[model samples]
Target: MPSRYVIVGGGIVGLATAHRILQDLPDADVTVLEKETAVGTHQTGHNSGVIHAGVYYKPGSLKALLCKAGSRSMADFCAEHGIPVKVCGKLIVATEEAELGRLRELYERSVANGLEVKLLDGPAAREFEPHVAALQAMHVASTGITDFAQVCRVLAELLVKGGAQVRLGTRVTGIRADRVLTDRGEIPYDTLVNCAGLHADRVARLAGADPQVRIVPFRGEYYELKPQRRDLVNGLIYPVPDPQFPFLGVHFTAMIDGNVHAGPNAVLAFKREGYRWRNVSIRDLAESAGYRGMWKLGRKHWRYGLDEMRRSLSPKRFAASLARLVPEVTLADLTPSGAGVRAQAIRPDGSLVDDFLIVRHGRQVHVLNAPSPAATSSLEIAKHIVAQLSA
Candidate 1:
């Protein structure tokens, strides 16, 4: 009998892993468990849809190493599979002279990561994005955009075709040495993989793995350009990195769907799956408020947290932030749009995990932290996780 491979979570990462397992060991019996009625209902479904080219990551990090390769593979896979994809490129703009140094650093880092980049002055930057404001910018030409949710569907279809089971609405409750206990019943498996994005840490602990990290949800809110104002952004317009902050400041993105998405200020989510302030959970709040990591993070970045919350509640503030990238944008041009909750892994020390965190425990593997580039790097991440399995 073939080894039964059971994967928890049906997001892009989970589905991609299932596809990889079948490719590596074609005879393996694979199963994917998703709590949602359909796949990609969370993080994979709600995102900026920018295919990153590893421009912003620190050199030699998993994100930097995998992103360039992932971009290539993702675009290739999308094209071969008949998915709509475009290499529209992006600009990391430094609106003020003080941010110029950071833009140069990002350019050098992009080069170190084996990517082609160009440093543009205000005039050259305007040549690319005529409506933008910039003292200087780093233009990353290989950045692209596509629908990651659709990618998940293709992976699911391919998995079923390979004699695998894609089970929906199956919530994992516990994990024994050789099986996963779900809301429905028990699922026996030879090996298990946890790609539970928001609940990854909990899932790890359920399987008796001391992941040493806690999953903290940060909700990123967005506003889209009104139909008449969509022309303000040409491609992805990002901000220069500010080392003092935990997140990159909000900017504009020209999504594949032709909507210009702007302003994603990160604020702590009361619920792990919270998309709005009203979507609260008493249980989720108790766990987060009770965690030492959450308290430590608040103590450390309380001011920034307040600022994020303030911005979240004010559309004018969001527009001001976006106006730094494209001066033509205004509060009147904005329209309410969707949001995505980032499953940021916070260590007990109050530090956020900056790279991919994959842990192996006997027959189980848990992904504790995978942030922004995750969607862009799902294919490569799947391969890396599966490569760790013992033959």
Candidate 2:
């Protein structure tokens, strides 16, 4: 008999894994369980949709390897399916003099990762982006943008066509040695893969595994430039990340739809799926607040958190932060856009699990943390996860 494969989560990674399973084990019975009414309803759908070009990751890391290969594969996948994608590239600008050193370090790392990049000075940067204000910049030519949600939709379609089951509105309630107990019923399987983004850690514990990490959600708030003000950015523009604090600061992205998204300032969410300040959850908040790692992270970055909160509350402040990269930007040109909650994993020491964290427990595989570039690397991530089933 063919093996019965079950995947928890309908995000891109889960769907992609299901897709890979059909490719490798054509006769295997495959089923995907997504709690949401549709696929990619969460992290896969709610993102700026930038196709990362393997920049900023440590050399020879899983993130670097997968991202480098995934960017190319992602762009190709979109082209094959007729999904719109743009290889418009991006600029990592140094607006402050103190950032020049970091900019150079980033450029070197980009080269070490085998990416083709060019370092440009302030005046040279303007040749590519007329309004950008920078002391120096590194031009990463392979960065692009697309709608990742659309990619998920195509993956789901392919899975169904390949004779794999795609079940929506099915939430996993419990897991046992041989079957998955869900809201709908039970799914017996030979293998289980966890791509549960926000609730991945919880799902692992439900299956009797100690992941040694906690899922802490951080809300990335964003705004868009008014259509008339869209000329401010030609493509993607980022800052030399602040080493003193976590996260890549606010940047401008010219999305595939011609809308420029800006200002995804990171702040801890009170709830796991919270997109706005008012969307709080008592349970999620209690879990996060009570986590020892959360307290340690807060203690180390309390000042930065306060600043992010202020920026989150005030559009003027957020625009001021954006103005560092594009001097022409002003508060008047800004309008509210959507927000995305990132499921970042932190250990007991408060250090983030920077790489892709996947651990196997008997017949189960759990993805503990997959941050920023996960969308770009979903296809490759799926391959890596499927490889584990054989080991």
Candidate 3:
């Protein structure tokens, strides 16, 4: 008899993991349980769609390893599926003297991370990005853009073709090692994999596994440039970033569709899935407030949290942050865009989990936290999960 496997969450992580399992175990009966009406409706769909270049992660970390490998894998998948992607590259520009040192360090780290990068001074940087104002910059040629939602669709299609079942609109209410209870009914499975992006901790708990971390949702709001100003950014343009905050800071990104986007200010959302300021859930609010890990995080990152909240409400303030990267951008040329909520894992001591934390029980695995580079690293992450399961 084939081994029955149940996967929680229909985001990129779950779908990718299911696809990987079928690829490895040809006869495995894999069933994916998604809480939403469709796949990739949450984090995977809301992302900025930038292909990460493995520049920011520390050397030899899982994040670095996965990001580097997954980026190439994602691009390959796109090529095979007729999806278009542009490797237009990215510039980590440094406007001030103090930022120049960090820019150089990033360049070195890119080399160590096995990425193609170059360090450029003022005039040299201007040659590539004429509108950018920087004393120095690190040009990462591997960074690019693609529609991850489309990628998810392709992944689902591949899974179905491989004889795996994807159960969309079936919200998993409870999960155990051998049985998964959903809104529709119950499913019998020998193994369960939890890839619930936002509710991973809760899903693990439902499976009778105690994950000591809590997911603190951080909303990232963006601005799309006016059609006339689309030419402002040829590729991705980023700031040096503040070391205090986990965010990559407000920057400009050229989408694969030819439109330009800017200013994804990171802020804590009142609700776990809150995409708009008016959308609020009392249960979500109370759950976040009641978590001991959140209390610890609040105490540590109160200032950064407040700043992000201010930017979330005030478009003018958000525009100013984007202006720091591109001087030509103004308040009028910017318009409100979609928001993405990051499922950040918080420790009891108020420290943010900077690494990709994967917890495994006998026949189950839980992805507790996979933040920014997750989309770029989804395939490599899937391979790693398969390796873990096989081991």
Best model per lDDT: 2
Candidate 2 C-alpha error for residue 356, in Å: 1.2
lDDT per residue for candidate 2 within 1-391, as digits (tens), equals 8899999999988998999999999999999999999999988889999999988888988889989999999999999999999999999999988899999888999999999899999899999999999899999999999999999999999999999999999999999888999999999999999899999999999888899999999999999999999998999999999754447899999999999999799998999999989999999999999999989988998998899999998888999999999988999999999999999999998777888888988889999988879999988998899898988
Model 1 CA lDDT for position 74 = 95
On lDDT, the stronger of 1 and 2 is 2
Give candidate 2 regions above 4 Å deviation.
Answer: 244-246
Give the TM-score of each candidate: 0.98, 0.99, 0.98
- 1-391, model 1: which lDDT tens digit per residue? 9999999999999999999999999999999999999999999999988899998787888888778889999999999999999998999999997888888888888899999899999999999999989899888899999999999999999999999999998999999988899998998999999999999988999999999998888999999999998877788889996665547789888888889889689998999999999999998888888889889889998999998899999898888888888887889999999999999998887887888898898988898888789899999999999988863
CA-lDDT, candidates in order? 0.90, 0.92, 0.87
Order candidates by TM-score, high to low: 2, 1, 3
Error of 2 at 351 (Å): 1.0
Q: After superposition, how far is residue 275 of candidate 3 from its true place, in Å?
A: 0.3
| Candidate 1 weakest lDDT stretch, 10 residues | 240-249
Weakest ten-residue segment in model 2 by summed lDDT: 240-249
